[model samples]
Target: MTNPAISICRVLLPALLLSACGANSVVISGSFPTPNIGKLPIDLAVVYDDNLLDFMYTEYSETGQEEYYIQSGQSHIQLFNAVLPAMFDNVTFVDNLEAAADSGADAIFVPNIEEFQLALPAKTRLDVYEVWIKYNMRLLTAEGAYLADWELTSYGKTPTETFLTTESAINDAAVVALRDLASTFALSFARVPEISDWLANR
Candidate 1:
């Protein structure tokens, strides 16, 4: 005779696996408001650390029930390219600082992803996931003189009753964080004292 507990497990295990498998890669997109910086055709070189492109995974819980991967390099690039025009009319991707200076760029922009994480559902709540992102940005003159530095962080929560819903919520949270970073950076860049000084000196 089949045990009742065993029968229930047989009926529920497949559903859990199916829900976990539904998690998929997220594609981020949005338009950012351009700050009111004066229109000067600044030539900027953008550089990204190679490690930023790597994907990292985190287990959902000690139960080993699920795992999720987070990757945001492509999304970051998309956001930067879309909004950078507001500050820099000419933007070039450079392999290194030397290349940036050699390319006749007025300023070099380096952005690094310090931390990217999506926490599993809260143990007590079981219905919310927390997403966090930390980014570091540096601006330098063509000759490598430091102009500005920024450390930005974004955190938010999403509802996640099921693995599929959890996945969707994570994606939504990531998009929100990315947009927040972009907008914040734009506003900060326009207000940076060094930027004003640089423009004045130019």
Candidate 2:
């Protein structure tokens, strides 16, 4: 005699897998607003390390179930590199505040990311992949004091929820996270005066 539950699981599993691999990826788009008036700086440097990633990864891990780890930090760095140019027109790097001050950077946009997530429904038929990023950056002066701390989150959705031979859902999740980071930061910067000043100077 065939077990009904077993039969149901067999049918649902494949269907879920199929649907899971083809979820729609959602993304937000935006840019920073022009400051009405302020002292804008130029030339700033970014210093990031394991401490920042550790904080972010911890938060990102909180949103999902099952044990997982970052296969590579390269993606996160690449994403930041991609978005930084667009965020600051005059951005530059220096060894420290002393160098930055000498270089005449009016301000800084120091950012620390807190979270990047890839999510899916638990025990579901489809692969429903989701990507998320949460981070905080401080805009500081050559004095080593902060002008403001900007907290940002970026999220993405996949086109579908299924995985054939390839893992489209996971890929979408990462891409979405990267794209949204730029968009989210752009919007947040536009809304914050200090950020505008910092970016203008950078």
Candidate 3:
């Protein structure tokens, strides 16, 4: 098949499988409550676990006697690193909380995952790995009072690729997860409609 044809197959095959599962096909779902917004205007301090990469793992697979591999969750820390500075200036995302407060933001928003899981489709006749990212956003006031909390969890599935390793699949899975998280946050926490518009464009 040509490149576009091959890509079309890759895209439609997943939809066919997911649709077959119907309600159980909820590979991604989560909620982010309205933020309190509090009484003061504040910039955001975003933080993540130092060992965020540790959440992922490698796996092996077999497809009709052919061996394959898969990769796990998205590198959210990397995404955070890339996205934060555009969200704030002069605020070290990986620094002491006190210092972040001194910089004069209304609240701190931490990016974290609660769970990630992967499962293979039994009928794909290929190895399947399921990946999930249990994520949440926490808001803290200057005095450290918990102002609001938003929980967002997402999951994705990938089978052993004809030509890719399980590790590579996992890495792809992570990207999907991060995109889901970004989409959720962009809709939920952005205070201004214009900021929300800007994120959607990106």
Candidate 4:
């Protein structure tokens, strides 16, 4: 007689494989409130490279049980747009060095997304989803002189129970990370020694 265990495995294996092969994709959307900080009395020009504007990240779970895709580029732009104006006298977007020089702004701000990392509940054996973002930020004069260059990082996490689907949880975590980024930049921008000096001189 065929063993009952063999029969059960045959019935369940395809279902398990189908579930494992499914992919989770999240298209992120984020917003931020204008920070309650004193506005710097300088016009600012911001530059975003193509890569940062259309950033998409993909990874497979450590156990190979799931795959995740996060599209976060546009949300980052939104976050900066919302927060920067509150911190500066004016804000403008520029396409290149030539545009930045001509923008009539006091300084140029460039932010590049250096890396993105994710942790799934499955991989961590925890009931949460986590996201990490690393950014390279630069402040320059209209004449292309570097005022400040630094690395900024942000992190966010959500309890798995907060969302029913993996996609939603991941998206929420990413949004949190973006908010963190905005808060950190707004609060710390003028505190950077070089930036403080520039503000003082201006």
Candidate 5:
């Protein structure tokens, strides 16, 4: 089916929509399939901060006729659950970074959402909905010593013609970003100097 050709101000659809000219509350259900990579021989602990678990991005157009919201916090956990286990022998989750020091883990990983941006076709004058996610990664030893810290970005876009509604296109774009994040993390983990050293010493 083809996307409906309608003005952003007239695209009032979906349960999370607002009565204003237009509003979109796109709920991104994650889809991070397990990677077909070998696991590292280490037990790991991951920390999910409250912000990451409840991440929501909201914005309004300058004209006050459009608003957008992306709910991705819950999906972030699902993304990690799917990828971390494939990258480590044993994976455990902790509420806080400090708690991991005593959790009998070899290392701790903390992923924080640095920024999330969305661009609708109306805003960018483009034919696609775009999503960009920036993440800050903190790596620590079991004893809470710093191993490494780095930033990574993931991007995704869905053609406007592909989805029948704005929220659907936005949702697909966000999913693509999450998938990119998972794949990039798994492939880049062993290449960081500090992390490689930690793995070597272990």
Candidate 6:
């Protein structure tokens, strides 16, 4: 006869181990709010530096195994596509500077990801993580002359008591941070005196 306690352990232990080994996948998305003011008059081209998209953060486990958390390239492109239309009446996404110039854009806006980091709690049971995203933006005329440069940083923290894995928590935090980033970009671009003056003069 099988001992009930032994049978229960035999069944439960494997399930617990499988749960611990499971990987989490999450999709990140954000919405851009409509601005009260009118859109900018100048047609602008948006370009992203592909080199910046190769960034990833690394984590080490207690057992000496390595883990990597990489940002989704599609997510970055989606954010720009979603937010730029709200800020400008005429916005075009261009793959290269030559394409931007050929498109007859007044100026080209280039955004680069400087840093993307994820931090997990010291203890695994905490089930929370923090994500940070930093971006550097440059505005240039169609003639390839620099107009202005700006830097933005955004961060977010995951829930402390959720049942999510560290990877899922990181994903959640990244979504929040990206949303904050888009909001900040819109506000800053609208309020910057240099940009305003350029628009007024143009």
Which candidate leads in TM-score?
5
Off by over 4 Å in 2: 1-41, 52-67, 94-103, 123-127, 161-168, 196-202
Select the stronger candidate by lDDT from 2 and 3: 2
lDDT tens per residue, model 3, 67-131: 22222223465555555554443335635567667756656666666665555544355576556
Q: After superposition, how far is residue 92 of candidate 2 from its true place, in Å?
A: 1.8
Off by over 4 Å in 4: 1-22, 63-66
Q: What is candidate 1's local distance difference test score?
A: 0.72
TM-score, one value per model: 0.71, 0.60, 0.56, 0.85, 0.86, 0.76
Q: Which sections of candidate 5 miss by over 4 Å?
A: 1-22, 64-66
- lDDT of each residue in 1-202, candidate 6, tens digit only: 9999999999999999976775444445445454445577779998777755444445556675555435555677787788888778799988889898888998999988887776778644554677888888889999778888878898877876546765666677887787788778877895666677787788
* Root-mean-square deviation of Cα positions for candidate 2 versus the true structure, in angstroms: 11.0
- How well does candidate 3 score on lDDT at residue 102? 76
Clashing pairs in 5: none
Tell me the tens digit of each residue's lDDT in model 1 across 52-104. Answer: 55534444555664455556677777777677777678888888888888989
4-113, model 2: which lDDT tens digit per residue? 99999999999999766543332222233232233223455555455543342321223344234333254555555555555555666554556666666656555666
Model 2 Cα shift for residue 161 (angstroms): 5.1
Residues 1-202, candidate 4, lDDT per residue (tens digit)?
9999999999899889976778667899866787998988989999988888999998776666447778898899888889989999899988887799998889999998999999988778998889999999999999889999989999999898843788888888999999899999998899989999888987
Which one wins by lDDT: 5 or 6?
Answer: 5
For 1-202, candidate 5 gives per-residue lDDT tens digits of: 5455644335545423645445668789856789999989989999998989989998678686448778899888899988999999999998887788879998899998999998889879999889999999998888888889999899999887842698788888999999999999999999988888878987
The numbered model that scores best in lDDT is 4
- Between prediction 4 and prediction 6, the one with superior lDDT is 4
**Cα deviation of 6, candidate 5, in Å:** 35
- Clashing pairs for predicted structure model 4, backbone only: none
Judging by TM-score, tell me the better candidate of 2 and 4.
4
